[model samples]
Target chain A: MSTYSVSDTTAPAAPRAALTFSNLSGRYGVGLAASLVWLAFGLSCLYWPDLGDWSRTGSLGIGAIVIAAFILFGTFSADYLGSAGQALRKRAPWLLAFGAFVTLWEVATAKFAWLPLPFFPPPQSILEVYTDDLPKLLDSVFASIKLQLGGYIIGATVGFITGVSIGWSQKIGYWVHPVLRFIGPLPATAWLPIAFFTFPSSWSASTFLIALATGFPVTVLTWSGVASVSSAYYDVARTLGAKPSFLVLKVAIPAALPHVFVGLFMGLGSSFAVLVVAEMIGVKAGLGWYLQWAQGWAAYANMYAALIVMSLLCSGAITLLFRTRDRLLVWQKGVVKW
Target chain B: MVVQSAAEAIIYPAVGAELDIDGVSHAFDIDGATLPVLDNVNLSIAPGEFVALLGPSGCGKSTLLRLVAGLEKPRTGSLREDEVRITGPHPSRVVVFQDPTLFPWRSVWDNVALGLEAQGILKTQRHRVDAVIELVGLSSFRNAYPHQLSGGMAQRVALARALVNDPKILVLDEPLGKLDSLTRIAMQAELVALWQRKGFTTLLVTHDVEEALVLANRVIVLSDRPARIKADIAVARPYPRHRGDPYLADLRKQILGLLGLEATW
Candidate 1:
């Protein structure tokens, strides 16, 4: 009756909104600027008389690749400053940059053999290698995705479910908690030999490794989540005569979801990181395996391309998972609706 | 009107004979020494009686309220509601605490509806939520969160939540003790209006002598720790009783004198 009025939510717009071209302008412009400076530096370095051990051409090619990586990262990070807009920063500029730079790279390497390798292919030849052997690359990519899917599913699901169960009640916690505390701290790769020996199959080994990697965090997050509900809330629920199952389903799970999802995102990322490394060990089909194979014979540019593709896939998966979290917790964005 | 209210009070002298606390006593160990809380307390509150237990802090006033709400049990004597021994918390008896205690995660409407939802009357219970929201003057802020509300509004939300459950008895554990004077006075006025309309039995615990005198038909005063009922005086004042009224002033002086804090007042 004597109630004061309450105000509505006032969620501030994030500084960098989705798909804004502001980051590209920053990342690429800064990158281009750095590349120009580096180019000048390399040209200046080329005139040194004592630079006979390493040829100027090879040094320039390697320096260009390293500078590109540095400048790309630099420009990209700066793009987020005025990042509030939602329009797709136009991709044409990025595409043109990628194309023109790569073409120059290919011509320099192929025509002049700027950076030569005995048993390995240069990037120009490697670009043609794709045209000549698209089937091989596709096969490897497909095999990797397939392995990743199975391993990711097994690892994430069991980890999440078991984590929640262990977190929710003391009984399971007593049984599983201490064991996980010790075992969970060990790196996932440590389990590879054991898994490979037990399973006798490369896929199972990778899946086991991946599950081991991601499961520990989920269990810990879920444990913390379930423990975090205010005892006052439990009293309220109990006073209301809620069943144990109802309490868990309604009060416990909903309260724990934000934490649970955080664990899930971490697990998803770990799975990607472990994917390539796992493949190179036992399996023959993932991006990791392809990178290793390309690197084996000193195919530096080919190795770099494979690395780039792997990075794209990894980033894409992570982005998708985060978007899923956004969809689930859109309310957390401070946009509450009546 | 005084004669009529007096007659009505006589007819239902005790809380219509529903709730009974029999010879209850409690204690807490402070500094490795046992300190008495409530001793030989015997009272019965029937349906629809708004009683205020007024006392100083450590007088076991809130402890007694908690006993009645079934949040705590007395060691010496049994407590009963409608002749049935009270044990754990029951939704039929809801409590409004001094602090707002509104769930931060829940919206205003959601917080109000939580008790009812817990009662399992969720779907097709439109009237319950709407009526309670209207009762508290928070229909406009039904979707607002506790963090977004002023302290006064949040307290009202807490009251609405208890009321929505249609509890047989409402317990106020120093519900308005934390409020500033202006807001507290306004809230007291509003409380009387709502109580008259709803007719739910209430037990308000407070240290404010004026508040106890204002809201309650009978204000039960208790002595300091190892509390005993010092006095039980029936009030004849009507709603919106003026602070400047000579009668209220005399009563205030009388209470302060009784509390042995006459020099301070």
Candidate 2:
């Protein structure tokens, strides 16, 4: 590795970088510009109804604008990488188009007051409603997320350790799998009545529901991950002089990571949904409780705000999870793969 | 017990001498019936010898390797290292499987270090990983993930993993079978180079007769299912032998002949 040869190697990197960035910019720029135009068009339709309405004769311009914004967002995000070799990337454009169509319908009902009633609230009103409860919305958001995260960690920790132990041992898998399968599919809600009678505290009842619901998914997923580890891995481990404990921890567990994470993500989602119901059932202060309270007071605006907070928190969690998966699995991304 | 006794009956052929395997046989319960997988197979590999077990699919060639590695116990006969019966996998015996079973989560160094780590080698001895990776010509990929490596690289990583423990014997089960033709050939040559450098007694099981002929000092051809050693052809070719060598082709046909496209029952 002489300096001259090193320089020779380094020189080629510039061209590679140039080519990659040029492709990236060329792809994303078009989508960005298209999105800007959508925003403009949407704004005009709202302000001056005569000019920008594409989907319906009379629709609020704001609804159209939101639709366009989301369309552009999806299109750009989906296309940035280029050539995923899968159908999802190909179908993304259509998905964005459909979203746009839905937005147009929403606008038409509210803006022009077409088919007026409780059927379709104006998109503008929904936005205002969301904004009105921003303070309380933040409160409920924190409250629900706090409970959800607590339950998820406890349930996932117990479930994963148990599941892996069970899966790695045939005798254990045989003993536990049948019992778990019978109990797992029983809905989280079904136990709510029993929990109400047994647990003295409403918070305990809510936490228990969250844990039970989330644990089933996490346990099932962990078992699947552990079971699906390749036979060759075991052979390699065996030949390498690994002890049984070494084999389980080193080979089986790491190989089962992606599957275990899938369970964690699913469990998180279910527990969140369950928490909302539990919060509304008896106790107060959580997002579900506040949502019910707002609805009872007929504060539609505040209710919408709480809903927005819920969406943001859930999507935020999903983004964090996907980012973690992507980072850990960098080798399986575009250039290098499974 | 039969297998162990059979191996015990034979000398390891002498110190630093060939491993003598005699009358090894095995069967598995397939659908509640005892299905014979190998029967009365005997072969010997001189110390530092490269012997490829050539056979068709389901011929129990892999089963034979697993038995040697102590991952499987044969029903009759035995496997031994230095005249001692091999009862379980130990750091002294390492195996490379067909799929290049490098742990996806570990880097190349960690994978290579796995064998030593299992033997309770101190963390200070971890530096030995670099030497093995270099022997495999995988120095550049030492930090790479299994998922990031090409098929050939993965197999090389697997070999490095096996060799880093400084095993007395190396067993490879179709280790290069997953690579494409060109990579397979390239890997075959690399394998021979590594064997010569490390000087570990090697036993490779493969479907490719030509690969066996090119690399092995002794090429053992097995009969179809319930496999037996049908032919034990001695390849007198030198190390780094070219595929174009004429004598190598002669040995290839002899191995193919033992496979018997027989009209004979």
Candidate 3:
């Protein structure tokens, strides 16, 4: 029996002692450096005289204290932190750099008024926007989320179906492929003028734009994905007594999924871009609307805050899609990693 | 040792299908030029007989096997299974290609169960999936995806996938051609053992004369391009036959002579 050995996945033997003096210094050195930098910068913010009125000095001190406390906990239970702790320990330099950047951003913008007033509000003023407009921000977040989800789901579903149809059937491809080629290249926002007139409501018009944006990439990729599937699989399935539907649904679809995911990624990127533009279509409450509203009043801090929120929201959606792709495409593990 | 549960899962033993090919001719359109491959090839394979089709490279032996598998229709004549003409691919006759062709997304068990699932018999014959996996000595890799498997293991999965269907006729288009010499030898023995156990009619297309002599009950040698039946040599030896037998050696010499190769060994 010429069997290959299966890899053993048991955790490496734990350190003999719970706490070791040698590794304590080795692991905690960078963490200690980060803590010291944050603590020093935080104290300076409290005591040092500011050129201008930067009101969030107190919060800076508190943020520093929180990070310091986490480092202290990490030092005591390195084993308990496990992989996350190990990552934090390894990324101590980058973390320290980030803290330094925040401290500099505060000093240069808010305290010193270096870059000029309305254009460059301090990080503290941005934080203050969160505190001052908590309710409005929450409403905007909810509304934005509702809009994003509605548009994304509709777009992705329609795109996937259209792609599979066009990819699988030559007849469908012959008719729909030319349309996809012509219209797919056009940006989703380009239809804004016509959409405003065509759709019954701005919401449907906006939704339609997002779907159009998402559907193109998905359709194109899916077509290629389906077209590129090795004919060997169909031959195998056919000889196995598989019906035509089974060949498409089971073999063709699963085989083409990796490519479909690539299209989904493209679609997601375009969806976000289109979502922000679509929200500018007289929507009552969304981050995009709020951004425009705040900018009109010259509350640049509020605009900055909205922009930050949008970044996080889009990133969160992308991360969620990645997780789904990972789960579904488990067979492709290790072959591709992001 | 067979798992009793797995053995119980398989309800039917493979009943070999008799194949009759009468005046079968095939061709291909290569760059808009008609390239004749097979010309009036005829053969009748008895039920449970293991026949090996031997030929030179580009001899169109694989095309012959593909015609039998019903993957392609012969241009001239008919291929019949017990007097019933084979128009298209049927579960009763399966071809194992040179490539393993296991679905990259599917696990070994899933690949083996594909045939049954395709026929909507997976619910009743699910256990046979495990049995076939075990038979291929891949029980531990049942959940492992195709990409994780070695070439030999992948080929075994392909074999198991075809065998689990209990195909009456099994076509091998140089299925073991890509394997390393050592694995190929081991697989040849395993193939013979499998054939003896299941008693399915086998048509193997190969360029390896020694391999043809080792496993086949009858060897059909084919001529190159516009492939004609050159020779049909029957081996009178029984199962577990010796490779170094004087008669086999003489037949090997004669086969080489017909192939226009002098016996240098």
Q: What is the TM-score of chain A alone in each candidate?
A: 0.66, 0.67, 0.90
lDDT of 3 by residue, B160-234 (tens): 999999999999999999999999988888899888878899999988888999999999988888899999999
| Winner on TM-score (2 vs 3) | 3
Categorize the docking of model 2: acceptable
Off by over 4 Å in 3: A1-10, A13-25, A49-55, A333-336, B1-11, B263-265
Question: Cα deviation in Å at residue B142, candidate 2?
Answer: 2.8
Per-model interface RMSD values are: 5.9, 5.9, 5.1
- Tell me the tens digit of each residue's lDDT in model 2 across A61-130: 5655675666556554553433442234355455545545545654565445555434344444555555
Please give the TM-score that candidate 1 achieves against the real structure: 0.73
Better DockQ candidate (1, 3)? 3
DockQ of 2: 0.32
lDDT of 3 by residue, A159-266 (tens): 899988988899998999889889999999999989978999888888888889888999889889999999999999999899999999999899999999999999
Candidate that would win on lDDT: 3
The collision pairs in model 1 are: A16-A83, A17-A83, A21-A89, A23-A79, A27-A75, A27-A76, B15-B45, B15-B46, B16-B46
Candidate 3 - CAPRI tier?
medium
Model 2 reaches an interface RMSD of 5.9
Give lDDT per model, in order. 0.71, 0.73, 0.85
